[model samples]
Target: MFLKLLSYPRSLIGVIIFIFLTAASAGSLVIVNILFNNRKIEDHIVEFWTRNSCRLFGVNVVVKGLENRPEGGFLYVFNHTSFFDIFAMNGWLGSFRFGAKIELFKIPVFGAGMRRAGILPIARSRREEVFKVYQAAEARIKAGERFALAPEGTRQEVESLGPFKSGPFVFAINAKAPIVPVIVKGAAAILPKGHYIPNWGVWKRTITLEVLPAVDTTPYTIDQRPLLQEKVRQIMAPYFHGDDF
Candidate 1:
């Protein structure tokens, strides 16, 4: 009975406050990133923004499988569902970089800020440009920085999963970094894809982050990326449908 009333103006108010706060704060960070070019500041700002956005939007996060994570540089891979996945990750996984779409980099200040923050811009439209993204990611891994990327490449609608891409695995093997598989559930309920505004109907919705064991790339060569990719997918299959992994 109480939730019904919260759904009316409360949801609308939540979305409006979320947009204003995120833009105002993130816009400042973007400009700072572009000017300073400091990775530390970039990470701190991203962590603050991602976590706080979830809070302001009334999204709760539940994290599991942290014991499976290693204490060194790794390639963190996950299934993409909604934009909230980004928040759930950075909010949980500490400091890490990302491989974002090139279009994001073209956004006036936001794009440039992402670049300064060590986010690799992936030009999926250009075949040759893909290698450039891989090269950049490899260097970051070699430098001992964790990177979070989605093998699915883009966000999918609720109750749906997209095909995974193997390029990130190949890059992982080349960098000799461990592959960390993560399964994020319930983001779609908080904020569905293609929706400009978020739903605060229940005041709070839990987004689960399942961090699976890392797949070591030491024994595998670049040529065997597909085999490694398939292994991780199988490990993540049950988790995707809300079953135990």
Candidate 2:
């Protein structure tokens, strides 16, 4: 009974901290957006927020593999395991927009901030919405904006990646951009789905953001979609499931 009673205050405190951090970060983003016309400057704001989040949650991010970003436009694909994946990626990657859910655009400050920051939102259930989102992403790439997407569609608690969604590949094909596979580890254990509070422990967590060599889809025709998808899947398998790809 006592343990259960103590849970309320703990949850409340966590909620308060979340709100405070969110507001502080949002305010900083707004200021940066207004003051800096450069996209790189805006990206730094996001990186700052992510780093702050890691500190606030006591997350230790240890990146591995190639960190060099390609010189031109590319579709970045990564494994999704937790919401913290956003922070982990944003902290490492620079000058890229995100492909996110449309519902996130309705979340007051966060939604407005994301839209302003060039994040493309889509309704996962609606095919038309998906197309619209892809079009926007393609346009952004044409305009010289790099973008990141999670082909897993949603977070999978297991180490193995879920089936690759065609949406990201479609964007890559349309934009004629190389597909860069990114792998992240240890986010799920820090904060899993359906859990509001992170499991705050002293153990150090390793978060890798590997930028694999870009995959070229130029030679493959539209009819060879399956081959293209399988190739990306194979390249990502090792990092997704902790094996050597």
Candidate 3:
């Protein structure tokens, strides 16, 4: 890994442009939300910003297993590693409401856009707030909405799958919706764990998004949530979180 040898100058230029682009994009999204406030149009705006950001940063996304996606009304779970996991999904993994930490929902213009666009914020530490968010999610799922949640809860480097929390699985059981496993690769290398700027190096970085087959949640009650989580993790481990990924 060339790391500093190749990343310094490249990231310097990339980060500078990224800041201006993000500011403009955030302002645009805020205005669009206040004006029309239509989710479909807001989704398009988000897609444009995400996809263009990836393209400009030399993060090429190759999505696989799109046919695995069902019609709607399912909880899509992902393995987290880098912040780009969110960006990559926004760019290439299809349109769906995703849950993000409450902190991201606190950003100035960006947070306002996210809030109005119907993105659910997870208040992980506050039990009452968490319940309310899930209550909202249940209503949306009942209305045949698609939602993506990361069971791992936070970014962690792993050889296969990270340790998963029970909240997402319990939510899936309660909602009685299917689980779609999405495995992401290559983002950790491009942006690393703690860095904000992505390293393009001397060539473009490729990020692969694999949408796995859906797992039915009908049989599992809240008591069987761990079993549900394990089954989905088993399917995802073979394709990601290793050198082959």
Candidate 4:
């Protein structure tokens, strides 16, 4: 019925509207950040925006294994899918900040807001600037603040799990924080690649967040990041159906 109601042209038009709505919400986030100058409030704003977006898009999120999340100082890892993946995670997952590529932190109001929203800028190498960011992350981790990461480094529309990056695992081990591997199913329908997760054909769909048991990072050493990364990937692979665009 939805397919009958939404033609290809309409879906394309809908995507524009979707992008506009996202932009407006993000602009509002920037305003909130500037006015409040508070990380906690900024967090609330981001969560609120993400929730409203799902509602607007007629997307439903079912979070399974939420109980597996440990209290404090956890590094959550996920399988990257759609652009909506970020929103879906924030809406269902906690208001924990995300660790993103450094280049994303350079994009105008989006970047500024992200900084106040406490999104950690993860760099490939240790330049002085990235070094300082790492220093801050270590302090925050020790202080019991939580964070999330997509180990695939970037989102792609694919049928299988991408290679997991070792950086986040290293970060987790460095902080002695537990790693919560999550399988996010059904996000690729929201936006694919080239055209967007999967042709933007889905208006209403259920996105599931299956949070697996947290892998204890305390025993992993810095040099063992690759081993730890593979271990976490193995744990999540079975549950990740990829449900891609």
Candidate 5:
């Protein structure tokens, strides 16, 4: 159905609508941020905008195991599938900042909004910048705030996942924060990687968020980072592969 519905005209229409909606919503966020200068309210705006954006694209999210999320400071890790992954996560995930690539921070209004909202930008190409990002994440967690990361680093098509990076695990241990593994299914169907236009088809538009139990990092030492990374990956692999929806 997805392939059959891949109409260029319809995709173009969807893209235009999505972009217009995003600009309007983000503009509203900027106004709110400038007026209130409050992080909490800014976060709510982002979440609200995200959910509305999902609706604009005909993407309906089904969340499971949200009760599994821990109360204390923790890091959420998810498998990267599509650009819409952020919308699915932020719409449901708590008021947590995300570890984004520094390049994203260079964009005009979007970058400014991200900074005002406390999103951490990590320069993956530079070791020092990466270290600073981890340090910031640790401090945020210790301060009782949460953060999220896609350990796979970038978007991947469904079933084409790459190895998880070790940076997030190291930050988890350093912050002594629990790691929550979330498996997102069906986002790729709505918007595949490298495509700006969304499919906007109901047949492939249901996205699910499967939140797994938090992995306690208190028991692991810095030396055991690899072991910890592999363990979390092992826990998420089954859910990623087994789900037919």
Candidate 6:
């Protein structure tokens, strides 16, 4: 039934409405953030946006493993398939900051809100900026806040996962926070990159945020960095290839 709507001429109107709602919600969220110093209120605002987004697009979000991470202060590493992954993950991982590109900080209302919410930004081209992001992330973790990052760095459509970046692992090692791997499936089909219109349908998609056991970096020295990186990759294998890690 939803797919049928996508073929209708009125679908464009729906898309416009979605954009308007997004802008309005973002504005309201910024106001809320200013009124209350508590970050929890801002999280609630984002959750509301997430729910509305899914509804506007007629997408079903089935969440699993909510019991994982009963508290905060963990690094969330997830597969990057589409833009929707941001909202989907945020809906589940409440009150957590995200590590994004510095360019995103320039985007009008959304970017300003993200910056005000304490999202970490890194200049991908500069090596020094990478360490700066790491330092900022470590400080946030120490301050009792959690962070999420997509190591793939960009969106790609493939059955197999891309090579995981080493930055996330390094941050985890330095911060001594648990590495949580989250798998988001079916978002690519809903909306792919370089496409304006959503290929909407009554699609039922699954977003699994499995929290594996934390990697203990206490005993390992900096010389064992390669082994530590491999260990984190092995733990993430289950989501990528269905292999038992």
Candidate number achieving the greatest lDDT relative to the actual structure: 5
Better of 1 and 5 by TM-score: 1
lDDT of 6 by residue, 1-245 (tens): 75575444444665787787767767777787788766778788778887767666656676666566635487878777777777677776566877888898787887877776777887778868887778777877867788888877777675345777778777877887777777677677767766665544433444444555555665555566678767766766666664434
Clashes of 1: 0
The lDDT of model 1 is 0.79
Q: What are the per-model numbers of colliding residue pairs? A: 0, 0, 0, 6, 0, 0
> What is the TM-score of each predicted model, taking all chains together?
0.90, 0.86, 0.89, 0.84, 0.89, 0.86
Q: What is the C-alpha RMSD of each candidate to the true structure, in Å?
A: 2.5, 3.9, 3.0, 3.5, 3.3, 2.8
Q: Under the 3 Å rule for N, CA and C atoms, how many clashes does model 2 have?
A: 0
- After superposing candidate 2 on the true structure, give the runs of residues whose Cα lies further than 4 Å from its correct spot: 1-15, 31-36, 201-203, 240-245
Per-residue lDDT of 191 in model 1: 75
| lDDT over C-alpha atoms for residue 31 of model 4 | 84
State the lDDT of candidate 1 residue by residue for 1-245, as single tens digits: 68756765777876787666656656767777668867777677788878888887678889999999887789899878788888889888778887888998877666665766778788877757877788767877888889988887788876455777877888898899999998898898877878766654566688899898899889898778888888888877776565333
lDDT per residue as tens, model 2, 198-217: 54433345666777888997
Model 4 residue runs over 4 Å out of place are 1-3, 7-24, 123-132, 197-199, 241-245
Residue clash pairs of candidate 4? 191-196, 191-197, 192-196, 192-197, 192-198, 193-196
Flag regions of model 5 displaced more than 4 Å: 1-11, 200-204, 242-245
State the lDDT at 71 in candidate 6: 59
